[model samples]
Target: MSVTETVGQTPLEAASPFEMRVDLGKDVPETDVRSALKSGEIGFLHSFTTGSAVDGPGIRLVAWTTSCMFRCQYCHNPDTWTLSNGIPVPIEKAKEELRKYAPGLKAMHGGFTLSGGEPLMQSRFAVRLFAAAKEMGIHTAIETNGYYGDKLTDDELAYIDLVILDMKAFDPVQHKRVTGMDNAPVIEFCERLAHLKRPMWFRYVLVPGLTDVPEEMDRVAKFAASLGVVEKAEILPFHQMGRYKWERLGLDYKLAATTPPSNELVAEAVAIFRNAGLVAD
Candidate 1:
């Protein structure tokens, strides 16, 4: 399908190359996330965790919201893809949850990170959550795919201390193949964040035979270099750790035989970005 056709269709309606395990019977209404900001209400949440270091600098209280537009084949959190799967947590209640970790987070020089399935899907909730965290003297960050970067207003972006932007693919066709969506929005989001001078960490998953191509890696590295605000580039080695989730969800496991990239390949990919003048690992 063309990018325009895919853009207009919801995940359920799109002709995904992979077997998707979405419930067509369940009608999840499109949430007016902006209205939630005005009402000071809760948002759909998958869960939250305390003391995660890999998510951001120091320990972090990472809140994973529900719903996502992409059906990434290598996604580890397939269960988080549906809105109906998550519980609703009030904005104030979410704040209280963050408060429990605030002291610890502050002492450790850590912060709160709003994460997937896609935090931007619940933009208002994230804004409110970040605002509350800042008010409590806690730093705030977000791990986003950048597809919906425009959702957050300048005021909302002000509350975020860092942005971990996941750039899936440098090639448009490959991007659409890996994620059942176009790369235009993601690239545009990166540009928007750059224009705003947002501190960012670029993340890319290295799937051995899929995204480890030298030419594409070079393009990705060049793009990252162009983003003057990028402080770090993380080359995440893809693994089968999330394969069980796909099986549990009854979705086709396309990469069941796929292996993580070799150490040499990882180093090579890292070097591509590092050579571009960015701190890569």
Candidate 2:
């Protein structure tokens, strides 16, 4: 279909990543979707939000991909858990969309960031899109869980300008508790980037009563400190903005009444990273 048909007259524009977007690719056959994922010619995007400064350096245009293996209890966009929920867009189309903002993005020192339910789930699409963005002279970043960090070849990884790794937890048990996944590959990815001297920004989500453990965060902070490539460490306080999505989708909303982390909590987390000699905010 066309962009107009997929979502309005232009590319899908979401007010924010928290906006509920679903069934954009519901009509595609399973076989075709699988083929596209393997080829990277087309990507399944949940939505693309423009003018985002929180995702990366300066103002950014961030694309949110669909599908993820982790079922983090604090996850806000539960709608992205299924790949088929995304809108199907060809690689060239995505490039065209990026091309439109390339000039302004460069002028503003901003670029493109492909975030996700877990972007590496659509590894090929993300790599190809990053390459396209690079060719356009636009900086590229990925906000990822680092679970599928191996999906990008070293050469492919070079296409990316920065990696905003959302390293949830360091301890395997806590990692599993937070994101329902292994932490080994995530750490390995961080180490690999350090070895390559690739620039990185580490982010940890501070959830009340769940991931607020000082010892656990200190471990993560120290690990990020050891990486040497982490230029910025951001402690993203967990918010309930996505709680409505779960309620609407009829999914079990565990953190139904969970509030955002207090300011003191945020400051303490930042201090932990700062104490490790890393620039933090």
Candidate 3:
């Protein structure tokens, strides 16, 4: 399917070639990744990391895939949102690099994490990659905004050991205004994942006057509670780390002049979600 067609469509009918998994024979072993890497057959390009301290439980081999559906004003890696960006490398290459970090990751009881640009946007590739990792006995996690859950099947969900969900905003109108997308699908995705009993970490970026509002926190807390599987709800204070990227990319930095929320404001927002019974960390 065309890129435009798949951009905002429901997951069940996803037809983007970039997001679909390409089978390379059932018996292909992880050892073959080296050759695949050398030949440049990776379906979606990835930014590989040997050890990432913040992504999950332990030091992790994080694969930051390129491609996202949202256009959030405060997004850090604005370059990752477009489909045509990033260098292509074979999936094998990614696996091989991750394998090298396996021992260290294991020591931390951490394995691998698949992060953006909206890793779920390329769920097909993610599914195959995670399956291959599992075959190698690696634990897996996905850090997403829950934007593509409709396209994700139970089989796909089963492969993921953990999910870090970003709840951008609680007010649908404000959410769309900030992210250029509706909040319903993201909200519904969380509910569905919760029903599946998936382990989840819900994140909310405390965007000063934009997202740290008490009412908004209550709404998000209400929605998160409905999911029940939320292990923790995090309030991430907004920062200007990506402001330069926006300027360099020739994109308007809409939130450039906005200041981050004060520590007291962040604390208040955290308390709101905390009161809802979600472990606010």
Candidate 4:
């Protein structure tokens, strides 16, 4: 049964993206779903949370969408993998949600950011949302894996002020092992963005035994440096905050025993990016 009847078609703003949500949009007819996807009339959203400082340049109102192509082992919100787990919100409504905070956001030098479950999974919706943010004179950003970067055309891409790309791995084998997908498309997207002169910030998660390989990180640093469009590289230390999500969803948690990377490990990763002549933190 679609949870729309059991619950509500519209979702209240979530206190945090970590809150579990399920089957919120399952009641919509298949035809309607397809229409929404094609026209960008609506989007499947997990929740909207305000006052995020790390997602973009300033404090931000971040919308967490549903559906993703990558099956990353270290995913924090496994529930977001299901499209129906998100509420089917019309684009206008989503815009209104942004409008509510526009004044304060502008005053704070903040804007809007669309994050996911891979925002590009709902390509049309993602573009439309960015456009709406731009209309309101707010800065816009998207956090993506770049697997479906082609989904947005150059015109549509203009609305996005920044692209916060989460890079899993640089090596093909390691990338496949981490995301169960090849990184070729990702590299292509990054190159395209560089050619377009789009400012970018690349983030690498420092998973001790998994992604902390020195040579691989060095390659990534070099790539970012070569891009010339990468303003900064961020080395994120992996954490166990999302382990319980995997358990609750009955998925195998591969990194259950893996502790967060030590400070020394994180420093080394940062230094690799810095040595490549890209500002890293």
Candidate 1 weakest ten by summed lDDT: 10-19
TM-score of each: 0.87, 0.96, 0.83, 0.96
lDDT of 2 by residue, 225-279 (tens): 8988999899999998898998999988778878899999999989999999999
Model 3 worst lDDT window (10 residues)? 8-17
User: Which model is ahead, 1 or 2, in terms of TM-score?
Assistant: 2
- lDDT per model, in order? 0.80, 0.89, 0.72, 0.89
What lDDT would candidate 1 get against the real structure? 0.80
lDDT of 1 by residue, 78-173 (tens): 877886565555677788888888999999999999888898887878888899999999988999999988887887899999999888898999
User: Each prediction's Cα RMSD?
Assistant: 8.3, 1.6, 9.6, 1.7
lDDT tens readout by residue for model 4, 121-231: 899998888888888899999999999999989888899999999999999999999999999999999999999999999999999789989999999999989999999
- Could you tell which candidate, 3 or 4, scores higher by lDDT? 4
What lDDT would candidate 3 get against the real structure? 0.72
* Tens-place lDDT digits, model 3, residues 1-281: 32223222322111221232212122334444334333334434435655567777777777766668899878877777754454344456556666677777777788888887788766666777888778777889999988788877988888889899988887889899879999888878887887889999888888865676788789988788778788888888999876776777789888888898888888898888889988896
Q: Which clashing pairs does model 1 show?
A: none
Candidate 2 vs candidate 3: which has greater TM-score? 2
**Candidate 3 collision pairs:** 11-151, 12-151, 42-89, 42-90, 42-91
